[model samples]
Target: MAYCAIAVIVVLMSCFFNRFRPLGKMLVIIALLLPQLSKAQKTVAPLVLNNEQLPVLPKEFYVAAVTDERDDRSAVAWLLPTTEATSITPQYKVDIKYGAQAAIKQFVNYAIPPDKALRPVIVRIKKLKLAESLLAGGRVEGKMEVALSFDLKRAYDNVHLIDYRTSSIYNRIEGQQYDVETLLRHTLEAGLIYFNTWINREADTNIKLAKGVKLIFTDYTEQPEGDTIYYSAKRPLRWEDFKAVPIGGKYEASVLPSIGYNERVEIINGIVNIHLAIKTYLPKSASWVRNGSSTNYSLNHEQRHFDIVKIIAERFKQKLMSEKLPVDNYDGYINVDYLEAFREMNIMQDQYDNETSHGTNSYAQQQWNEKIDKELGK
Candidate 1:
């Protein structure tokens, strides 16, 4: 309770020392919060980042985050027994502490590349407390606070202290209106958003999983897919997936197939483990139409475009299997090869459109379909 009270004090006076207050305020707050800790504690195992979901955040700079600072080993950031709610979608069992460490861990790991994740940098999170206030109209104002203690060589970590916070007021009903777990998840996101603005690059935590089950062009067996968006063009493209605006002249539609990839290297026991992946993205929002006259024909043409990207991604993956990059500066190493391959892919995409006259040349379109299929087969 004392730590919770300290969190409230920090939040209430956050604006007081916006410039230099964070440093001195922490010292004062910690001194006051030690007496109110609850004796009984609950523990939930730390949540682990999925191997594929994790990336080497740095080719050079590495990190391993530590989220637990509680002396009692409890993981629930803040617990409230109030069950008054209007709705509860998926009710988390009452009295059980949800794993807060993993919640913020998931938030941070997804925000950076693999190299950075492995950096010696330690992001120690402490004093994560949540509080709520009853307000007008039976509304409840929830406050989430996390004291982000880090030796971030980056200015984002300052002597002044990096305090993360987010709050919201929601309509209160009865019977645990909604899952507090869900709200807490959103709070972690908001806190990270505030933390990243000055500390690291901003990132989105709500990105969809990047695998396209039906359209894989290559077998990705050895490496992990960290931030890749993989799609297969072999199966064919449905009319529903192409939603990009058509800007090319005289063409009713355009399928902008994108092949993207990234590489990471870790010198584990002097043996460099190269983690690389290449995948295709079929941008639904950026692809659209003004005509459905030749829907089937146009779709086939677009499918070919997508297939071409898959072919390139497959080729890129193959290149990684054989190529040996200089490890002196891994961050700068793979760029040379991948960038060239990317340019070649774009060129081939454009060449197909030009030779087929945006699918108007039926003979050439048929020729391209066969050629790309043959290459893909090989």
Candidate 2:
């Protein structure tokens, strides 16, 4: 009896050990792979290009990037790394494939997948040896093997694009072979440029697509104490305020006289509540100064611009308060009034600068300052 019991115990122990052994090995393998696989799990964001460095993209077209965000439209794309880069880049270069998405969207609107965007445009690259015979003069010859494939199901109905693996691409530079980073960047820029050009030619017969502004909708929630609601009359302007970057031209100082607002439309107690506000700001990010010689004088000119914006905003507020607005179409109604007020502000601003000659005309500047003060009081 004792020998039989021992034999049964041995068999049970061996089975238990066999199960735990594989589990232990799996844990070890997972520990080893955790770091190596981290990059695969991480998401790459859209590429930020220096607008100055970018060549003029096809007139209105853009390259868009696929993101984790829920897209209501089709044809979004992501970039992936399929092979080890022989190129010396710490990171890959990619753009928002907006132009491609836009082109695809025109054709495959409802057919696109609802749960996720299209397949990633995979990029793979490797290096090649230098030519046996080199050009004696200034030319240095180099070559590279590259392949790319973008899913056209994104462009077509249930059609997969080319195979990145089988697609053979060769690029040779007459100059010296560049580092992996430069090579990758050059390839990306060139590839996107060519892709955009092709899409323009064939993608749509929708009467030639023209680039336009994309609309973004913001959501709002109720807060107890503090919320961002800018009211023009409630806020005023100040000097010694250095904000706003000067770009696009050579100027000493610029006053960004602007208006911005948000609205919260909610139902409370079976009644519709629309909370809207418009106000002006003097921000330091977009304004700039080239010289301090005329700082005080230039500041006054900028102040007038703000004052003009304030005047327009106040008038806009009053206009809204007095009118009977329809709940369903309230947004459109408000925007029409808001845009009209801004158009008037623009005309006034142009007149202010033209009459003052950007503050060169001392007489006109003083007269305008007094007029603005009187209107601000009203």
Candidate 3:
């Protein structure tokens, strides 16, 4: 019984040693790797940007916002090329003094201001990375890539104006890491100087930088060969132009005429030029006359209606030519003026018909004919 008990104890001790043997090996391996793992994960100190290195621009611009849009925002550069002794790689982060966004903003603000009165712009840092590779003969190669976009800030949105991309390559001895900051500062300065030169050249002619609006009036004229007749001082209305079927109404004759405009916009020398082509037209298919009422007198009254439309078009042109339109909402102001002119056309036509009783009142008709002719002569 004693021998059998000792045998059972010996087997239990062996099983316990086997179970704990893997755990002891794992602990030893972890202890050996602790120092190397910690070193591999270590980060170098952040870079510092030199503000005095930036250049002043000819035309100042406001830096409204700055954003870092790189895919990996955690690190801006990788430091310490792999050597035979140490193969671990370390990352170089943003500037410790100002960080990425703040660093760029401060650099730009040194040359310009944050004032809203200046030309406002936003800067996007698309790519900012510095990479190093160990080369033969104890030399290290450093390459930097930087991409930036400039946008103009408007009332409700932003307009992209320009883009700049640049890359630089340099060679140095293994321990010369200070070139990273110098290279970064010089590259940033180059981008700003490029933008400044571009804006200075473009400010006078680019539509996006227009400061005011201008109005140019033109009369719409076309060949008198189509179904539609464009109003002209020399082309008077004839009785044969009426082609539509006469509707059943108390009036003996009817004419359909209207006023409208076509617009063409162009910018010249930092001014928005709005060209308006005024059109006063009569559609022959929509005008009709009773067979017996086609008298010179009755025709004269219908022509006066057409003349009323032309006069209103002239008045519309005068109104816009006399006022200063805001550049931000010039189209809206033009639409308002057009609507007012349209209402005026309707009221004037109705008043003429009401006073003349549809051309039956002889004295009133005669008075309208003279009034219409006088306005047209002007």
Candidate 4:
């Protein structure tokens, strides 16, 4: 209105001065209209997405951040249709008040309060667009589309949990712009409600939401008929299993054995279940007997070395089963326990060799054999 008034005054003055200087009047009119033309060509007014229209609900997640990732970040909507009248035609750009990210953050917070004691999630606004088309009988049709992805925020990273996308079409009298906000608000509400329902249904079973850890230990018993002998009460080591050439040592015979485990991890009902396959084994190629010294007593001494490895493996399982393991670092804890068990095995092997004098002392050797058999539950 102010511009119109200024134009009218300028035109009146130009007419009054036309006879005195015609070029001056034309220049004054052009000068007066240029500013108005510039203002019209500038960006159109922005539409505010009011959050009050969004209805609150019981939600399982709170919005941590809202990111606008649309290809055309200049505007969230286009209010005016072009003369070509096609869905892809460019129109007057209309932006959300403040910005899309800020406005959506407000909208989500209004619907699901920030103070809610719930899971924290980031919302990626992949698409948020409103377009209008001129319809017959002086009416207009509007389409609003929204695509969003939800991510769970962990300590150092984020996990993509779910995605939501929806589009709505509505009809309104030409120039009735309020429908845009209504549709947008309903779309956002629908997204939030969908997520709430999804989480309620999936919270118990989704691996991404698992909160605790569990362990299931299984003894590895699948041994093929081969040179490697896995420890079993039914399959005691025999002298033939010692096939390696004896190294020049004071001991009559020697055996090489160790303990190890393989782990398989799974998440069920929001718990991380670690399945461990524990094994104690010896390879015939690594165990040897000296010539003319493969007596039952010497063999028993070597077998005790293998038995000590089995005992340590059992102890390793017990150590883990008796304690609560943290979900985030359970592997590290298992490794520490394994290293400790390995060290214990070496110490016990050395002690047995020293006390029995490498099977030389019959009384001490008998005492050691009894201790090994008792521990092995013979």
Writing each residue's lDDT as its tens digit, candidate 1 over 162-259 gives 45544455544432333555555555555545544534331111111111111112333223422222464334566666555567577777666686
- Output the number of the TM-score-best candidate: 3
Model 2: worst 10 consecutive residues (lDDT sum): 206-215
Ranking by lDDT: 4, 3, 1, 2
What are the runs in model 3 whose C-alpha is more than 4 Å off?
1-43, 53-56, 60-75, 81-88, 113-118, 133-141, 171-173, 223-227, 233-235, 243-250, 318-329, 343-357, 360-378
Number of the candidate with higher TM-score, 2 or 3 = 3
Give a tens-digit lDDT track for model 4, residues 107-158.
Answer: 8887777744777889999999987777777666778889999898777668
Worst 10 residues of 4 by lDDT: 81-90
lDDT of 2 by residue, 179-242 (tens): 3334434544555455545545533322112111112222222333132222244444334345
Candidate 3 structure quality by residue, lDDT tens digits, 1-378 = 333654565555557756777555545555575555444433355777767634564454677888888887666776653333133445345443557888778877775656676788889999988877666787767789999999987777677889999998887775444456778878888888898888878876777777788888887878746888888878888999888889998888899999998999888877898888888999999999988988898888899899999999998988887888866678888899899999999999999999999889999988888888888788
If both were scored by TM-score, which would come out higher, candidate 2 or candidate 4? Answer: 4
Q: Which segments of candidate 1 are over 4 A away from where they belong?
A: 1-229, 233-235, 245-248
> In terms of lDDT, which candidate is strongest?
4
Clash count, predicted structure 2: 19
| Deviation (Å) of 28 in candidate 3 | 38
**Cα lDDT computed for each candidate against the true fold:** 0.53, 0.48, 0.78, 0.80
TM-scores for the candidates? 0.39, 0.37, 0.71, 0.66
